[model samples]
Target: MFFFFRKMNAVYLAAITAAFFMVACQTNPNAKKLDTGTEGTIHISVDETYQPLIDSEIKVFESLYPKAHIIPTYKPEVECFKDLLNDSARLIIVTRDFNQQERDYFKQIKITPNSLLLAWDALALVVNKANPDSALNMNQVRGIMDGTNKDRKWQLVFDNANSSTVRYIMDSINKGKPLPTNTMAAKTNPEVVDYVSKNKDAIGVIGVSWISDPNDSLSIAFTEKVSVVRLRADNGSDFVKPYQAYIGIGSYPLKRGFYFCLKEPYRGLGSGFATFLGSYEGQLIIKQFRLFPARLNVVFREANLK
Candidate 1:
């Protein structure tokens, strides 16, 4: 009888241990995988134009969650999209969302992507500190882009031939027209800035984030290297710089959407990072980068002085 009771107790203990592990597995399905919402490692792609801002975001996120590791590949926007489509990356940060065709393809594959608008980013036109032509209207910009601006014959420089900044100029500014023969590709934003800084006649077209972070020493140095051009809207009378308030109010002429598209089927690190970007803390970081935070509500009050 003692032997029988001991055997039964051992069986019960084994069953209870098994049940406990089963419940744990059910509670955290990601335990079997390497990644979860708040833990593990993941690879993501980001547009090189937003490298500065996204770098800061990742640093903070990883610091807060020590076990979460995000490896980001910064490349052209088109390449980032390619990484997403090819499953090379679980998340991508770019200036636009998936088009209808991409959506349809994902639907066909039974994958639903989560795309969130992160912020409003602006393209900053930078010129040499010696260059006096710092302000331009919309028409003038169109002329410069299309090689029709005989007024100054300014040499146009872009970060990359396939970069979002180039696409923005072609689509939004040039109205789908081809870039002029004079437009040069500098490979990266910093190179564009460097080129423009050395060439008085060259204008570097880059994302505002490259030079917007007042707290970053590199950003401050970039700002000091070149003069950011003020842009007058097509209809507005005032020429405004790419300040956060200007971007928020649509006063900045070269503003574009910043977005994060996650292709995670589960609530993994990609989703977690995406949620963080739209959260108050993430939006605050975006604000610090000087981009207009789309997820945060900011009130602009008018104050008058006597």
Candidate 2:
């Protein structure tokens, strides 16, 4: 009888231990195996304007690390921030960093979010091939944005109403003023190009990446559909296109920084990917996309020709 009682007690304890581990696993899926820098899966959000560049980044990253999988959702910058705040995304790539309120909220939650300036991006103004006005100075650009230009009837088109490009224009160009009453909103950058291609009087605001990739057939097609508008600064004499060298030299009129905000508490896949972006290889990819790389040091030299 004593031996039988001891055996029954051992069986009960083993069952209890099994149940405890099961409950722990259910509570936290990563309890059994924690995600590391080079391994595991993560979800991230990216601004739609950066889809082309980021797609290449992810493809290379996954190929390098077969154990790591990153699922990304492309949306507007505002929506990307919403995903970061709601804990739906481990990282987000957008035009700006976290504001004061966002930093405060993360502090309150005892989470320190990381922000990295990845590259310098340019906003390209495109018009129909038949549109004769393919160049504008700062004053004319502002007038068109604010609906104050009376020289010509222009229709302004944007990728989305809440996109980062619109925000940049309102804050930097328009000086907190509202957009024009007749401004149109296309669903995506490609759609904006399409709209401008069809409307001879329309001007489309899009990211340079959409039409800058020389190797991409779609990018070449976009350039064929519309002509990129040359922009002159308020005090500058020459009109310049949004070339990578112009952006690097501060000659481009419309430029913004690309950033990544990460919410991972541990050194997980998010941190790994962010590190990769700031690495030498990653910056090379960015430069190939015709954007000025922030992490890589590039020198410009002037030559005297006869």
Give one digit per residue, the lDDT tens place, for model 1 in 22-120: 899989857666588889999999999989888999999999999999999999999999999999999999999899999999999999888989899
> Each model's C-alpha lDDT?
0.90, 0.91
Clashing pairs in 1: none
As a whole number from 0 to 100, the lDDT of residue 157 in candidate 2 is 99
TM-score of each: 0.88, 0.88
- Model 2 ranges off by over 4 Å: 1-32, 214-222, 303-306
Lowest-lDDT window of 10 residues in candidate 2?
213-222
